[model samples]
Target: MLTLNVVNKELCVGDIRIVGVSSASIFLIGDTEVVSLSSMFDTPPESVIIAPFVPLPTEE
Candidate 1:
């Protein structure tokens, strides 16, 4: 399992079943879940992509 401390308040945890490291991005699979974390070659990412398969409930 791989864990990343993101922004000090949030944590990005995933089991590294496999890693496809390219010159562009790093792909990971955790507990039947797949995610991609990438850094732009020219620009930085303003937002990260969260997999829809992982759900977070909204509060009303």
Candidate 2:
């Protein structure tokens, strides 16, 4: 899975007060995904980004 840290410093889009979400998109260039991180409360997140689907790597 993609991580939020790859995009920005925080877990949300705008300020923690306003509305935004932890979102990211995966692009398959070299089998790598470009992720963007942000957040939402009870509702779903906005913005539609698309990319290839790859399984998350398992930890040793």
Candidate 3:
């Protein structure tokens, strides 16, 4: 059993610039009662490839 409550009177913002946001993420400005975020990145042993060394040609 769980109970949550949130009350906000006033909120103001001028300018907000965000470049990038990745994975399990939560971007909030005002108010929040409860927030839960979880991220899991698993790379297996046999899930990787290694063998490449090619340089790009430069402009003359």
Candidate 4:
């Protein structure tokens, strides 16, 4: 199964690579990122679990 680190310092993400979103923030991810991440595992996982979105603070 594929494994991933929730946090990493060396990895660089740009603004355009967002995958998920919340009212306050966005998830930075891309197709290439997923493919590269998938390769990290010897066996594929059944599915990926994503967190639920939440509301962000309003911008006055």
Number of backbone collisions per candidate:
0, 5, 0, 1
lDDT of each: 0.45, 0.41, 0.60, 0.47
What lDDT tens digits, residue by residue, belong to model 1 across residues 16-60? 333233334444323434465554444455555444343335445
Q: What is the TM-score of each candidate against the true structure?
A: 0.18, 0.16, 0.40, 0.19
For model 2, how does the per-residue alpha-carbon lDDT over 1-60 read when each residue is reduced to its tens digit? Answer: 634534434343343231232244423322234445575566444554544443554545
List candidate 1 segments past 4 Å from native: 1-7, 24-60
Sorted on lDDT, highest at the top, how do the candidates line up? 3, 4, 1, 2
lDDT (Cα, tens digit) per residue for candidate 3, span 1-60: 466666777888898755544433466897766777565547875885533433435545
Ranking by TM-score: 3, 4, 1, 2
Which prediction has more favorable lDDT, 1 or 3? 3
lDDT of 2 at 34: 47
Give the TM-score (vs. native) of candidate 1: 0.18
In model 4, the worst 10-residue window by lDDT is 30-39
lDDT of 1 at 32: 30
Which scores higher on TM-score, 2 or 3? 3
